[model samples]
Target: MDKPKRRNTETDPWSGLKMYTAARIALGRTGTSVPLKESFAFKMAHAHARDAVYSSLNLEVLLQGLHAFNLPVHVLHSMASDRMEYLQRPDLGRMLNQASSEQLKEEGSSSTEIAFVLADGLSATAVNEHAIPLLQLLVPALRQAGFTLAPLTVAEQARVAIADEIGELLHAKLSIIMIGERPGLSSPDSLGVYFTYAPKPGLTDEARNCISNIRPEGLPYSLAAEKILYLIQEAMRKKLTGVKLKDGIGLLQG
Candidate 1:
């Protein structure tokens, strides 16, 4: 038996072409067999797994970021080192403790047209990433538009309902609370803002206007700021917000 002839460029012009074709087929470019190792689905799954680990909120980092803003901070419940404690005790998260409430009452402004508050609702990463920038953009815009701003507050262990509590604490005609929205795989650092006109206890979500997903991939800061200011103006003009304000006034009109 004779050995198969070795093909080379010197021997045959088609040798390189044959080698290339064989390599391509071996790499599954011909689609005879699925390339499980290099498949897009496999790469995507690996990417998602990495993101799940890295995108998780670091509350300590988040707190440091908020502190950099030089805003007043208050905790609603006893500080717990455990994340589960903070998540499980939502009742503790809803209202400021007596000491915090007193301090808020003593230190916070009593009268203002609008008050701004930040809360780590679910994704503390949201506050660190989106909340501060959004608030910074909004506050100056509101002031430029002749809206008065109360002292800003950072509420720990706070929920959405705590906006009403902070509103009542500051006695503000309108209150805007920026919170970390529940994280999804697509948006781990999403920020949401809820604005309540004439905010007080017993108010529901229906009693406030909300702007969600304020991260870079969502609404831009300048646009979000403009929309918030416009909504505040509209709420003042109509004396209502949330569900009561018909015609969807001040909502991102073309």
Candidate 2:
């Protein structure tokens, strides 16, 4: 006689009965192979576990991603041989060196209507990525509106206050500075834009207008550029900015 073929189902009637009974009791219905992993509860539990891991890492990775833009603008440190010296000396970063200042004085036009400065304030990566695209958008827009942009400058070891210095140096009617903001573990490579009408030393934050969070995850580059232009126009008209201007104004507000 041919050997009996083994069945996929339980051969023992009692065992099969017990499994069936347990399935009905535990799951309200059942078949073989519990199917626990395929259930909705298992999927939801797995998703939560993945999310927990991502939340722990936070925004630093996202900020670093901004550096991938690989912009073509000149970096001040590359042009200056003493980049490390300036970084070590905060005072040096606050003002252009004698050579650079003199160069600007000689080559810079006195009738400059607006000045654009890019600075690696805290995160060079942020300025390298966001600032270039923003300027690409802004420079053309301003030009179309019949405004002249002064020779652009990229400052090394720059602080936000340097905008005032550049504005004074160029005699620009308005100065716009794109700088890297203080990196948070949550937001490492964020960029900030500061616009000042007639910037000068000792000018408070209240005298400047700021558009911050210019990264892929924060403010998109195109939108940030437009807002900066709008703010510059308003600042020129009102002769003031910052807290004095109406808050909650701009394309982003909508």
Candidate 3:
């Protein structure tokens, strides 16, 4: 009987497609199992995803970076006391703690047209990396459009819905939260933005619009800003978001 022929990855039919994407497409096999290199690469990607999930955001560094925007910034915390509790009790992560609530106390209703919130969601790595770069583009465009902006709020152990309460407290008609999205094996640092009109406590996910994958490699900062700004303008005009609203690429041009 002839010896079993060895497989060479270079000759694999799918190998040519590897250059087009970061996805796992052409991993060659060793007999019936994945090759050692592919298996090791997958494990490393998995480790990165786990690390991103458990990572902590450096508040001081983040705050410093945000200071360039020349807006008042506050650090807030969710009802969850720690990462463990945040993971175990997701509901707690969606609400503000007593002190955080007090911090927003004096903001009267309709103080601003929009409030921007940054939260260390499932992937702090994402917030720490992409949040500011995206904001750099977004804030200026919003200002030029004559939108009144509220102070920036950065929260810890937070979930997506926490922005609703923050926006409510800040008395903003619209609330935008830039959060770290759940990490995938290939995307350990994907950022997501959720915006809602008439933000208030107890609002559901259906009341918001999301712009996701704001990392440089995923959705470039400029493009993300464009999409977000378009949503903001339309939401302001239409006075709604979520399922009821739709994306319109036709942004007004000068």
Using lDDT as the measure, the top candidate is 3
- Candidates in order have lDDT scores of 0.70, 0.65, 0.91
Residues 110-207 of candidate 3 have per-residue lDDT tens digits of 57999999999999999998988888898889999999999899999999999999998998989999999999989999999999999988989999
lDDT of 1 by residue, 101-202 (tens): 787788747588887877777766687777767766766677678987666677766777777777788888988888888766556667888888888867
Instruction: Count backbone overlaps in model 3.
Output: 0
lDDT by residue (tens digit), candidate 2, 1-254: 99999785534445546543312223322465445644665456456433322221112332343233332222232222354554566566666666666766676476667877777776766776677677667777888888877767777667777778777777888888888876654455678988888877678787887888898778898888777777777777887777876534544567
Question: Which parts of model 3 are misplaced by more than 4 Å?
Answer: 1-10, 107-110, 250-254
Q: Give the local distance difference test score of model 1.
A: 0.70
Ranking of predictions according to TM-score: 3, 1, 2
By summed lDDT, the worst window of 10 consecutive residues in model 2 runs over: 52-61
TM of each candidate vs. truth:
0.70, 0.64, 0.92
Worst 10 residues of 1 by lDDT: 21-30
Q: Which residue runs of candidate 1 sit more than 4 Å off their true CA positions?
A: 1-82, 246-253
* Ten contiguous residues minimizing lDDT sum, candidate 3: 245-254
Collision count for each candidate, in order: 0, 0, 0
